[model samples]
Target: MVKVEIVEEKDQQSSANSPYASTSSSRHSSQESISSISSELSAEETLYDRINALVDIVPPATRHRISTKVSKAVSFVKTGGKIMGNIVWIVTTSALLVGLPLALSLEDEAKIVAQEREMMAQQQGAQQMLSPGSAYPPPPGSNQTPQKGIVPPGF
Candidate 1:
């Protein structure tokens, strides 16, 4: 509830001139002023005043129940958000802790296997170049025949 007071100053010249005005005339003027002021105040009612009047129509118990329910709903949403954040953090952390090491180990094993294969191929090529009865034809003036079933490097 709000209380408003409106004060207006009377004209001294008018009062002095109407020092002997009839009592009926004074009463009429006072009633007219009161009515005009009331009308003006009603027309200028604030949004807060209208809403407060509307809320007053509802029962107190119902308002209390609605407020409590709304508060509970807000708290539940907050809790769920926190839980979701924690789950995401745990998942990402676990992936970095476990998956990362396994991937690195697999990559290193692949590199080692590739290096071993390369070393074997080099050894085979050296042996072929040094062997007398290789896949290639013999040197000039030399009496040697090509091998029967040896495949060249390209094949």
Candidate 2:
């Protein structure tokens, strides 16, 4: 029949346009993808349900004990934090109140002592320069003779 030949010709054209195209295979692949997506969604829901179900299975006494232990641990951590904070505050305050001034005073004392030593050295040099003796006196602890060409042992 002419209609049958037309349908056969249209099918041949479709196959020529795309050699690998097939309606059955496309439907099967789409079905597989849809089923896989649904399975994943169901798996997630099942996991959520399982987790929510755990709340009903624990006994009240066990839950109470767990809660009490958690509360005690929290309180202990809070107390320790407060104590450590107080200790740090005390140390910093003491350093500012006591240690800073002590360090400054010690540094000032050292500077004063150094200045006095320099002044004393200058005074001794001036006294030596003003003296009328032709030769300066030997230092108290000296053992070396003051001969003109004498060299110290190390030098």
C-alpha lDDT of residue 16 in model 1: 58
Best by lDDT: 1
- Which residue pairs clash in candidate 1? none
Instruction: Give the TM-score comparing model 1 with the true structure, all chains together.
Output: 0.50
All models, RMSD in angstroms: 13.2, 19.9
lDDT of 1 by residue, 67-105 (tens): 999999999999999999999999999999999999999
User: Candidate 2 has which clashing residue pairs, if any?
Assistant: none
TM-score of each: 0.50, 0.54
lDDT of 2 by residue, 1-155 (tens): 35543334547666857847655678897887787765343634777786777878999899899999999999999999999999999999999999999999999999999999999999977786455431444566765444465453357
What clash count does candidate 2 reach?
Answer: 0
TM-score of 2: 0.54
Question: How many clashing residue pairs appear in each of the predictions shown?
Answer: 0, 0
